[model samples]
Target: MVIDMQKYFLNPVSHAYVESGPAITQKIKALQDCCLGRNIPVVQTRHINTKEGAKRMDRWWGDLITADNPLSQISNDLKCDKATIITKEQYDAFLDTGLEQLLKKQGISQLIITGVLTHLCCESTARSAFMRGFEVFFAVDGTASYNEQFHLAALLNLSHGFAVPVLTSEIIEQLESRT
Candidate 1:
């Protein structure tokens, strides 16, 4: 699952821009391509705020990504046409987003997570997925944050308790070996 790879977090001009966004975007694209080639379903998440859902988020961040915002759109670099797009209002993708049900419907028991804001959306989703009984593989190199410290801190915390932290190349090699 790719979490919040929209321009809101990726584009440098954005207030929420992640410094590692460009590098991670390329890595995520590679991982997505590999998944597509192997017929493994790729789930992409877009974080958007609705008036009702933005209450808490707005209170905390004082900003929101509304549906009409161009930055709210998923990055064009990703092959979204071949992936399932999941729109979410919170940091946790499974929160109010039928993401768990969608994975179950597709017989997907595991999720490889990638995208921006490693310390926020990605980490939250990883923890949520783990609690929901889904095995989570967090893409260390395919996720980014506002700074390296935040990114590494998230990876460390997640690896200790919630997820298996892995690089994009390692994931791709493992998938290739399986086939």
Candidate 2:
């Protein structure tokens, strides 16, 4: 699952931009390509705020990614034509989104998470997925945040209990070995 890899957080001009966005974009793209080649489903999440769902986020951040914003769109660097796009309203992608149901329907018991805001959406989703009984593999190199402190802090916290922190190359190697 790729969480919120939109231009809102990736483009340098954006207020929420992560410095490592470009590097992680390539890492995520490689992971996605490997998954696609192996017939492993790739689920991409777009965080958007609806009037009804924006209350908490609006209050906390004072900003929201509405549907009409061009930055809300997924990054151009990633190929998502074959991915299952999940439009989410909260940091946790599973909330109010049909993500859990969709994964179950596809017989997917594990999720490899990658994307921007490692300390926010990505970490939140990883915790949520673990609580929901899904094994989560968090892509350490394929996720980014506004700064290294936030990024490393999230990885440390998540690795303690919520997720298995891994490199993109490790994931790709495992996938390649499977076939």
Candidate 3:
């Protein structure tokens, strides 16, 4: 479950972008490659702004990820031809997006989450997945934030209850061994 990994939050040009974006992207790509090699389905998500109800968040952040804006585009490094891309209008990827349906269609009850803004979209999606009965494995170095404090805080909270926090190396090792 990759959440809100668009350029708007992972690129340096965005105001709330993560500084360690490159490293995080590399780790996520490695995990993605491992999953794809084993025929595991990968679900990637991007956040897009909507005039209907996402105006509140846009106003609060003083930024908007317009549907067709380049800033809303996912980084090339994290995208793959075989991956499923889900576009969301909110922080929680399952809120209105067909992510749940897609996962169900694939018989995916477990999620390995990686993406931007550890405390925001990533964390929110993790908790939501847990609530929806999916076992969530959250990647430590595969997720990033604007600062270390925010990143660590989210990981701590998530590992305590919402998800199992694992390193990218661990996930790749497990996935490889499974095959």
Candidate 4:
């Protein structure tokens, strides 16, 4: 699953939100293309904030990522037309979303997680997936954040308990090698 790879997170203007966003966007697109070519199911998630819910998040992080904003739209580089797009209101993609049901419908028990804000949405969803009994292959370089330390922290924490940290290339190779 690609979590929060929208312009709001990936654009250079939002560097304060995620410094490595643009580069990570490219890495994620490459991974997405690899998955598409291999016929692997790819789920892309976008964070859409509601005005009412915005207040809560704003209190902590200030107003950002409003719904209907172009920033909230997924990056054009990542073609979600061939992927299942999931809209989320909070950090965890499965919260009140059809993610779990969709996964079940497709008999998908494992997920390769990639996207922006490694410590926030991506980590949240990874933990949630693990708690829900899904095997998580978290891409270390596939996820971006404000800095290398923050990104590594999330990878460390996830590798410790919630997920198995992997590289984008490794995942692409695995998918390509699969029948």
The lDDT of each candidate is 0.91, 0.92, 0.86, 0.85
Give a tens-digit lDDT track for model 3, residues 55-112.
5887788767888788888887777889888878788999888889889898999999
15-132 in candidate 2: lDDT tens per residue?
8887888888888999999999999999999999987888688888878899999999999988478999999998899999989999999999999999978999999999999999
- Pairing residues by index, what is the TM-score of model 1? 0.97
TM-score of 3: 0.95
The TM-score values for the models, in the order shown, are 0.97, 0.97, 0.95, 0.93
| Candidate 1 deviant stretches above 4 angstroms | none
Over 80-159, each residue of candidate 4 has an lDDT whose tens digit, in order, gives 77899998888999998889999989899999999978988999999999999999999888898887888889989999
Better of 2 and 4 by TM-score: 2
Where model 4 places Cα greater than 4 Å from the true spot, the runs are 15-17
Backbone collisions counted per model: 0, 0, 0, 0
Predicted structure 4, TM vs. truth: 0.93
Winner by lDDT between candidate 4 and candidate 3? 3
Whole-model lDDT, candidate 1? Answer: 0.91
- Candidate 3 clashes between residue pairs 3 or more apart in a chain or in different chains: none
In model 3, where do residues sit more than 4 Å from their true spots? Answer: none
Candidate 4: residue 84 lDDT (0-100): 94
